[model samples]
Target: MEAEYLRHGVPLADYQLTKADHRRQREAVQVHEWVQRQLAEAPPWSDERWEEMRQLLGSPTPPWELQRWQLRLYCGHVIEATRNRNSPRPDGGVCDKKRCPDCGLDPAVIVAFEPLGPAAEPPAESHSLRSSRSTRQPPADRRSKAELVAENNALRAELEVLRDQA
Candidate 1:
């Protein structure tokens, strides 16, 4: 994953530990600078602002499409004021300041770190049976919009019948 970060926008096939660390640190700094630039052009951040930034970055990969939870790791800032000194952030950095520059939030938070590429895919199909048994929902897209509405109405009627029976 560190290697992925190092090779993001450059032609480095392999880098020494110091070089890799430098690349990651450089990218992190760039992210911060980008945010500052956005804030300069537009004071506060928003979904639209992030979309603009994402478009400018031109990829959904790290240091770009990263969610707020993940952003806290990279930015050392958050929307809400927090002072947890032990909070683990990206690159093993921590910020206990009342006003952190890197903190922000989004509607969705990704709980795990994932590097770009095919390795991000799910585990092998050997556990397909277990996964299948747990998830019984039909694919949502299989039904048309009208079909879904009709099914919802039928389910409501069935629910009312069950209530009356009770």
Candidate 2:
């Protein structure tokens, strides 16, 4: 029975590995073809294209544009204050003073307060597949094990035919 699974003087395991390699090569070729199609369809790079790319790469809001107050604690530690947060005064009178993130023992003096800007937009794309997988709601496959095995066998036969043609 095991001898029947041999292909062209090759062991069943070796044959299976070759078939798997072919499948991987076919997938890589498909990805290259898709990229070629995209390049062919895409417009040539122009100033507008550069600007679009820049916007895509750029942060939605500049970091320096945020309402930030540089607070200098009497303990010589510098900390930043954001919007709606209590800022230390120069005279150490308004809000909570002597509240340092590092020391938390001395009066904090407001060094500089900048003009506030717009809120930052949420990121367009996730950094990684693993992180995005949690947000992706793919449909559940409820196929039976037998049905899946039958489909796999059919695909394998089809692949064999394709391989022979190639």
Using all chains and alpha carbons, the TM-scores for the candidates as numbered come to 0.21, 0.22
Off by over 4 Å in 2: 1-66, 85-93, 96-98, 106-166
Residue range 1-166, candidate 1, lDDT tens digits: 1222311211222212345444655655566668788879976678998889988988544322232222222232222221112223322243211223444322112112212223233345634755777887877669888988999999999999999999
Candidate 1 regions exceeding 4 Å error are 1-17, 43-166
Question: Candidate 1: deviation at residue 3, Å?
Answer: 18
Instruction: Report residue 136 deviation for candidate 2 (angstroms).
Output: 39
Model 1, residue 72: C-alpha shift (Å): 16
Tens digits of per-residue lDDT for model 2 on 1-166? 0011111212222222245434544554566568789999998999998899999888654432334444443344555554331222222244334356887542343222332232243244533544678788656877778989999999999999999999
| Candidate 1 positional error at 119, Å | 20
Model 2 TM-score relative to the real fold:
0.22
Q: Which TM-score value belongs to model 1?
A: 0.21
Which RMSD values do the candidates have, in order?
16.9, 28.0
Q: What is the lDDT of residue 73 in candidate 2?
A: 38
What local lDDT does model 2 show for residue 96? Answer: 33
